[model samples]
Target: MLENTQISILGCGWLGFPLAKHFIAEKSTVKGSTTSADKVADLKNAGIQPYVFTLGANNNADVYRNFVAESDVLIINFPPKRVEHIETLYPAQIQEIASHIRFRQKVIFISSTSVYQNTNDWVTEDLVNQPEKASGKAILAAENILREKLQNRLTILRFAGLFGYDRAPGRFLANKKELSSANAPINMIHQDDCIRLISAVIRKNVWGEIINGCADVHPIRKRFYILAAKKLGLQPPEFKEETTVSFKKISNLKSKMLLQSTYKYPNPLVFVL
Candidate 1:
C-alpha cells in the first residue's frame, strides 16, 4: 500500500467530497476540484487542496493539464447535468481530460450502472455495454476513451444508485406521492461503501479493471422504500404500478476478487430502514 501517495479528485461534489476525506484519512495528499470558487475554501478546510475546474462545452485545457500533471492517481467523479446538447458536451469533456492526463499516472473513472440496459439478466463486467439511454451511451464513450488511452493504468468503478448521509432513501419517498415501478429491483450502494471500494483499489494498486461498486442485496423497489418509510414513522409512498420491471442486476464479485474488499454496507436495507 502506498501510504503517502497523492490523489487528485475532479468534481468534488457529493461523492467527491467524501472520497477526498477518505483518502486524507488514509494519509494521502488529496487535491479535490469543484467548479465553484466558493467551495475551494471549504475543501481546503477539509484537508484537501482544492482546484476550480468546470467541464462542459467550453473547457479550459490548460487548467486540466495542470491538474492531471500534479497527481499520482486521478479520480474522475464529475457528471455533466442533463441539458440540451449534452451528448456532444459529455464526450468533449472526456477528450479534454484524456488529452491532459499525465503519462504513467493511475486513473479511476467513477461511472454508473446505468450503462447497463434495462434487461432482466444479470450484468457483470464481462457483459457487453449496450446502453439504451443517451446518458448511458455518453458515459460508455467516456469509459472507452479512458480505457483506450490509459490502457493498463486506468480502473473503472461502475456504481449503482447512490444514497447515504444527506441522501437518505426514506426521505426521498416519505410523502404520500405516487411511486412508479413498485416491483422494480433496487440496486444501490452507500457512500461509505464507495469510499471503501476506492480505498481498496488504491491500496491494492488494482488497475486496468472495471469493477461494479454496488451492494450485493437486491430488493423490490416498493418494499424497500415502504420499509424505509415505516422505520422512520412516515407514511409509505403509494405505488403506481406493481408490475415487474427489468434491470441488469449488478454484481460486485470483481471488486471482491480483485481488491479483496469486504463491503461496509453490503445490505442496502440496513441503512434504508
Candidate 2:
C-alpha cells in the first residue's frame, strides 16, 4: 500500500500532477517538480512539496538532489522536446536524472508507445522495432539510457496515444485535409486509464519490467477521428482513401495480466471527453 510512503514525480505536468494528487489522497507524501515556476504554487496548494526544477539548467543542483533522494518511489514523467539532435540530447537528459538516484529506489519511467514503429501488426513489450519518426527514435534512446541506469528498481510504462478531457482527439485532425493512413488503425488510451495503470504498477509492486498500457480495441483512424470531431461539433477532417491498412496495434495483455487493469474507455470511437 502507498500509505505513509514518500513518492517523487520528476515532471509534474498533466499526468504527473494528477498522479501526485492521487498519492496524496492515498495518505502518501508526494514530492513534485516542474520546469515552470507558475505551476509550483498550484502543486503546493494541493499539498505536494514542489520544486522548480529544470534539466540541463542546473542553477540549483541541491533542489533536485533532495527531490530524488527523499522519495521511496520516483516517477520520471516527461517527454522529449522536438529539438535538433534529440536522439543524443534526450538520453543525455535521462542520464542526468539517473545520476541523482540513491541506487535502488523504485523508479517508474513514463515512456511512450512511439518506441515501436508501424509494423502493420500487433506490437507488444517483447517486440523491439526501430521507430520511424525522429521523436520516436529519441524516446527509444532515452528508454535504453534509463534501463541501463536503473535496471534493478525500474518499471517502464509505455502508454499509447493519450487523449481525454481537455486533450481531445477531435481537435487534432478536425479541420485537416488529405491526411494519409485513413485505413490505418489508431492506438490510443485515455487520461483516466493512464493514471489507473500507474497506480496499478505501484500497488502490484511490478518492478524491473516493461509494460504497454493501451486499450484492447483498435479502431480505424478515419472513423474514430470523424466521430471524435462530430462529438465536439467540430468540422470532421477529410482523409485520403487507402488501398491497404497499416498500423501497429499496441497490445495491453501484459498490463492486464500484471496490473489487473481494465480500461475505462476501451474504444476510442465512443470517447467524447
What TM-score does candidate 1 reach? Answer: 0.93
Go through the candidates in order and give each one's C-alpha lDDT.
Answer: 0.85, 0.87
Residue runs of model 1 more than 4 Å from their true location after superposition: 57-59, 174-178, 230-235, 242-244
**What digit string (tens of lDDT, one per residue) describes model 1 on residues 1-273?**
656899989889999998888888888888888889989889989999877877753557777777777699999998756977767778778888788888889999999998888778678988888998888888998899898999999999999989988887887788766677788878899998898888888888899999998898988888899998887788889988646666667888888899898888889887656
User: Which is the leading candidate under TM-score?
Assistant: 2
Q: Summarize candidate 2's per-residue lDDT along 1-273 as a digit string, tens digits.
A: 989989999898878998999999999999999999998789999999998877887656687688888688999899998998888878878888888889668999999999898898889999865898888888888888878877868899999998878898989999899999998887899888999999888888999999998887888888888888888899999999779766899999999888888989888777753
lDDT for 15 in candidate 2 is: 87
